[model samples]
Target chain A: MKLVPTIRYNVQDIITKTIPVYYGVFTLIFLTLFSMSKLTSLYMAGSFSGASFNSTVLIVVIGFVYTRSSFRYLTQMGVSKRTQITGKVISILLISAVAVVMDRLLELFAEFLFKSTEMTYEGSGIAFSLFDAYLSKLGPVAREMTLIGLGYTSRVMLLSATVFIAMLYVRMNTAAKVIVSVGIPVLAFVGMPALAMLIPEQMAKLIHTIAEITGLSNGLPIRSILWMTGGTVIFMMLYSLITRRAPIKD
Target chain B: MSSLELIGISKSFGNVKALDDINLTFEEGKIYGLLGRNGAGKTTMLKIIYEMLFPNSGAVHMDGHAIGGNDTALGKMFFIGEKNYFPEEMKVEKAFRLMNDFRKDFDPAYANRLADAFGLNIKKKIKSLSTGYASIFKNILALASNAPFILLDEPVLGLDANHRDMFYKFMIEKYSESPFTAIISTHLIEEVADVVEHVVIIRNGCIIRDEPRESLLDSGYSVSGKADTVRAFVSGREVLGTDALGGFETAYVLGECPKNDLPEGLEISRMDLQRLFIQLTNS
Candidate 1:
């Protein structure tokens, strides 16, 4: 069936309503830290990293704010829940992708303005190396483009997971919703690091094996990136399935 | 054979039963009034039909197809509940655009005309609109939906007299222009009595009266005279209700009063929809 109209409406709603509200809050925090001189360029980079890590969590929070009456309103207006859910997920991804791209571009611009190009590291760490291996299967130009695309896609998937989780919690009571909303990121932040530390030797060996198989050098960032990206994808899939069966309030 | 049908529908919240073994049917091209007191299962029935709420037992069907949560069945129906479902932050025009995108039969021109008629600002956010205007906006959306089976629960709530009149006029006009089945559940019986062809009154989660308006009116009569005379005249008849003020009395009787048998100084009139509704439901 033709799905463009529903997608367009949903995307526009997220762009105009959800994204602005979210980005506004983020911007306010960014400006406040910057103005206080409490956030140096290093802090900016760290915050961006934190944002990327919690991207799904951010999207879920925003989704919770908008999904209840907004989703129901669309349904009441004759849009099917399936169409709405699909459109919403796509819109969340698009917004997340756009936000990440904008942040990276802004970071590059800030580096140039601060005359800190020498101090800045453009390397993608293990993430870039693993991506480079896959990219090398294509040519050099294709590799660069694919790397950029993967970065963008990774960010989008993370955000989409958040939106899915938030929508899933739509039918939950206020306290339970807040718990789930806050719990996802807490689990991600605490759980991943704890897992990594607990199995550092095994993780290190796995990284070495991956590096050897990909013909990459030791200490490549690709292994870390793979772990993070794989975790994100798994989280997103689980979130989508949970939301598909989520109880909606009438 | 029926445009809409419900079979053995049952719903409960915790231990309280909202609907119990409810069965209803609606024919095409007729306006039905779903009248009920508060918490009498009218909204629950409508929601079940629209698939917003699932019946704990039995099924709802439309045109021989089950009205589940599928898009096909949902596309053929429309429901307007008491809640203002629009986002509080959305502008009127944006809301219209959203509606147009979702509902295939949405009439943008009609919505615009209603907006203009009601003096609703297209740029104003829904949260900013007055209560009356908010209801006006919702009514306009319902009117422009053009669905075959439209369920409006208290569509005239919070509307001023002028707007309520306009709403009725618009409903009649829309019905004439394109005949459709409409179920309007409202407590304002008199406001819609003239336009509605059928009346379905529910009391305590059961169908107490379901008949054509003409048939209902034909079966009941209002007798007014001196207290003693009216009481004596109505004593042998099925008395639905009685209202006695000082020495005068008016009794609403359920059966026909023959023209040949006239009680002295007693005046008898045909029961209108409002009186019939009051007499039948007051108990």
Candidate 2:
């Protein structure tokens, strides 16, 4: 009945669980890369992109754990399933936005540090955020907009994958769980690619068409944002269908 | 007064029926002890009432409104189960704060005081707690929740003697301060016998007894003496069970003791709740 507290609690939970690890790993990687730049003549680049990638991974993990962990805890607290699922959706969006902002901040921080310190070093440096790495040709405003779109799309895609897997795992028996746990990755990494080999041209065309429609091929991700938003809704509906009457298992 | 009712509730896992066509009601402002043997569906029934499990037929209602996915109705009840549901990395105090966030009446001060009384370090992560401490932590949360209905499944599962004693004391203190409905489902019937005002015994997924504690206890009496004397005294009476050791015997009989007609050799005593439960639910 009270949506705000549920959403607030879930957001706090996700942030408390993942954000610290994100920042810790970011600091470690940044320092490691900075020290390497100081010791060698090689140009150090792509640090911000690496941070963004890590954030995406963290979001994906959050999707799975939110269902596995928060769902159980909240249910025990007498939160209805609808409230839990709604909290989860809103929490994902909020945390994903936070991750995007953190990515942008990390980019700025890295750029300032590298550029100011380049005069003292033997090697030059460039800190390319995901946007710079992928869409450097876009103007300043377009680049920022594309970054927002890219962040939303990447998080939605990963969240869909992990939430689908986690929900199916929750609803399944031991044997089905084991099979699914082993089957999904194999299907994605080996089976799909292998099947694609039998129809390389069609697969290639499909990929290209997807990229074109999403505007990623043209260095703009505006359409991808709308498409991924739609994808998120569909994934959320599937999550609800799976969990509406689902009982908590041991 | 508010009441929680289960009408024709049934649940099954594969071929095993955990609960079957059961109807029950829990009235407000009273303590109820749900007595059942292992696999007698105490946990399953409680879970279904808490909406953690869905029943195959019928539904749970609070004040005549279906509680299936209704947040307002669900929010009125808080359930603490044997397993830890808090995030493993969450600290005890943080959990208290989170509870406060969710339940408007949650008393953080009371929870902290209870934590101090239990010697539970507020900073310790839930995963680091030993078995007894985990139970204590969950119990403390339930006691401080201030929800109208609190369901505890195996609330004393891992508690030692002293802590269990302290918990019962605190539970009574809290309930006296503000009366709320509590349904405590546990295997340790004796420990809760004095605390529960009402008793419900489940056997083979069906409720065989549900009544006030005094009435349930009054339905049986035990006689102990020499084997032959005890048997002779209980002869023609409704016998629930008997235990014999060497020349001594104790016969559990289903009826009030005729206090004035006590035989010379046999000693008559009120049957304890544990013995009654064991006799009634024994296969």
Candidate 3:
């Protein structure tokens, strides 16, 4: 069957209204990160440890804003439920990809302006580490592309969870929309680690063993990635099912 | 096969009954006006016919097949309500694109022609348009969709007289080119009387009067004269409604009034749709 025009229109709507807003926010985030990196260098010399905090804050902010805008557009368009959800998924992926690329570019600019040193390349740069890992698993070109693709997908899924949670309370009102937009990401950011700590010692040991097999570790970044991905996926799946059957008054 | 049919349909909201034991049928190539007062269950009936709301009991059928949620039968039907349901941020062109996608028979050229006719700006967002323009754009979409069965609920609510006339003219023009079934639910009976063939009057959640407009007009009569004279003439007759001014009284009575027996200065005229609707609904 041919794709419904509503889907195409909704996608176009996402590109027109949602993307620009997100790009604007992303620019602000990149600038903020750049400044923070500089400040960290000035204070601690070689120890710039607030990178994770900056990245998390930026991702959550962008994700929440985009999700709220997307939901409003989808509902107002009178798009069917399936198209709304699917269009949102596609939109999230697109925005997330742009955000990831912007983040990397900002990192590169920081490295160049602050370090100001040229060195012989043994492998890809620090920003390319994720891409290199994916390359090692897949191949040279495919792996690099796949890593970008995966990063985009991961970001989209995580943001979709925020969209879904926000939707539960704000499906009908703008005030609720704002509340959920800010609430879900903050909860996910702060709540996941606390929940992880609640795991029993034996279960933690078992999880650690499994993490080793999967090349995961107790490293804060890896643990945070796992938490974000797992939580977002579960939340998104549940959200999708709920929204699929949600009653639409208009 | 019938173009549309509703069998034993019933619906309720909370404790209030919106529709009760309703059945309706429509053939192809005919225009029907669903006439009713506000809250007379006209919208509810239309919603059920379009499968937007499922009946608490019974079923709707199209072409001898039962209709359900997401039914293809709905593809053959276009339903426009009083509200502007299009995305607020959507441009007129984008709305057209959506119509073209969901409705297989949508005519883009016709839509554009109607847009030009109505002076609607294609680049304007739906929310930015005036209420009249919004109604015009929606009417254009309904016309362009080209669904076999078009159901309009107060489709001209926000339109000015000029646009309303333009809408009826366009409808007639389109109907002449390709005859299709339409059921317009509106309170503006007099305005649509010239084009509408059949009228279905609803009252208290039921079809009270469903007949050809011509037949209804032919069968009803209005008598106006001196109060005593009109009263004498209408005594024991089926008087639908009556109005009095000073000593003179005007009475709308169903069935023919004998010309020979009328008083000399008394006036006897055939009832029109507006009178008929007022008589039917108010009584």
**Candidate 3 or 2, higher TM-score:** 2
lDDT of 3 by residue, B1-283 (tens): 4578888988887898988888888889899999989899998898777654557898888898886533356667777777665657779997787667666789989999999989999999999998788878878877888888888888898898998999999999999999888899998888989888988888878888788888878878999999999999889999999999999999999887576866776899887898888888895
Going through the candidates in order, their DockQ values are 0.35, 0.68, 0.16
Interface RMSD of 1: 3.0
lDDT of model 1 at position B145: 88
Best TM-score among the predictions, by candidate number: 2
- fnat, candidate 2? 0.82
Off by over 4 Å in 3: A1-4, A15-17, A24-250, B51-55, B256-266
Query: Comparing 2 and 3 by DockQ, which wins?
Result: 2
Sliding window of 10 residues with minimal summed lDDT for model 1 chain A:
A45-54
The better candidate by lDDT, 1 or 3, is: 1
2 versus 3: better lDDT goes to? 2
Each model's fnat? 0.47, 0.82, 0.11
* Candidate 3 C-alpha lDDT tens digits along A140-161: 5765555454455456666766
Stretches > 4 Å off in candidate 2: A13-17, A20-54, A111-139, A197-220, B224-237, B247-249, B256-267
